[model samples]
Target: MATESRHVTEYIDRPARVVYEYAAEPANLAHWAAGLGSSIRREDGRWFVDVPQGGRAEVAFVARNDLGVLDHEVHLPDGGIVYIPVRVIADGENAEVVLTVRRAAGMTDDEFDRDAAAVATDLATLKQILEASA
Candidate 1:
């Protein structure tokens, strides 16, 4: 059982209070999530992600809090599925986000690799936006 993993670390010049607000807000997910070219839809207690390259993924929200984890299941257009584990940790002047995606059918390893950088870029962009406002 090999798990696909990616990690991104950034030092934000802004305080946690400001960054966390944007990170923790469910609606604000689109702002950053879009960087990965993902469209998010929330309805019926589930968040759906429309990934053009991979396909549609739907995850039921189990729990979401200030310092907590969000679990989602990635479903392929061809009927394959895998679990995507995401965690958000608050760092004094920065925040740590870890997104782990399990590989599924119709998904290539390269796609996962690409997302690793895409996510980091998105976070860095967010960092820039928040720090600029501060």
Candidate 2:
């Protein structure tokens, strides 16, 4: 069955490379992504982060690149992998970050909207963190 997906974009007053360099680091997810955790720890060659709901999650990042591609798969506690695609693009001297969130099946409309909002908030935090540092 086809699923619902949405994309949210945030603009930051920083260069794309600077934003990408910081955001691309999987270690920084906890600082920006509330749905993830406040701290991330590496164990047994795998990276993990604490979830707000009292559990930890496994995060497997894609191969690093220089083109501002920061894609990773979050292994949910239920054995489902949520693929998150984040991009940092140059907009003049500034940068724009775009995130794509895919709604899982059986999610109610309200739940879907909430998930999107959470992502937007996280992206905003990311923008704040990056821009403030610039």
Candidate 3:
């Protein structure tokens, strides 16, 4: 079975370089991605996030690059890794941030819709943060 993926995009009125710099930082995830938890902490060369439920998730973020590639994987306690692919592309004088979410196996349509909406909200928050600073 093929998995379904949704790409949620938000535009920020800033240069791609500036947006990329802000978005590529793993530490910034807490400020924008509320679904990822607000209290992400790094310890022993590993980052961890408090899951909304009753547990903490070990998160491994990809190395930051000059290009806006903020892909990360959430390491679930059940040994499953959920990959989140995010990018910022230059759009003339502005920047477009796109986050791709894949519908996990057996996820219902309602769940996927809610997940996509959450991702969109997160991206909007990101745009607001970067624009407000400029």
Highest TM-score: give the candidate number: 3
The most accurate candidate by lDDT is 3
lDDT of 3: 0.88
Badly placed stretches (over 4 Å) of model 1 are: 35-38, 54-56, 101-109
- The TM-score values for the models, in the order shown, are 0.66, 0.93, 0.94
lDDT tens readout by residue for model 2, 41-109: 889989998777667789998777888888888887878888988788899999999989888888888
Q: What lDDT tens digits, residue by residue, belong to model 3 across residues 1-134?
A: 88899999999999999998887776787998997776788899888988775578888877978777879999877778899998989999999999998999989999999999999999999999999999
- The positional error of residue 18 in candidate 2, measured at the CA in angstroms, is 0.2
lDDT of 2 at 38: 77
- lDDT of each model, Cα atoms only? 0.63, 0.86, 0.88
Q: Using TM-score as the measure, name the better of candidate 1 and candidate 3.
A: 3
Worst 10 residues of 3 by lDDT: 52-61
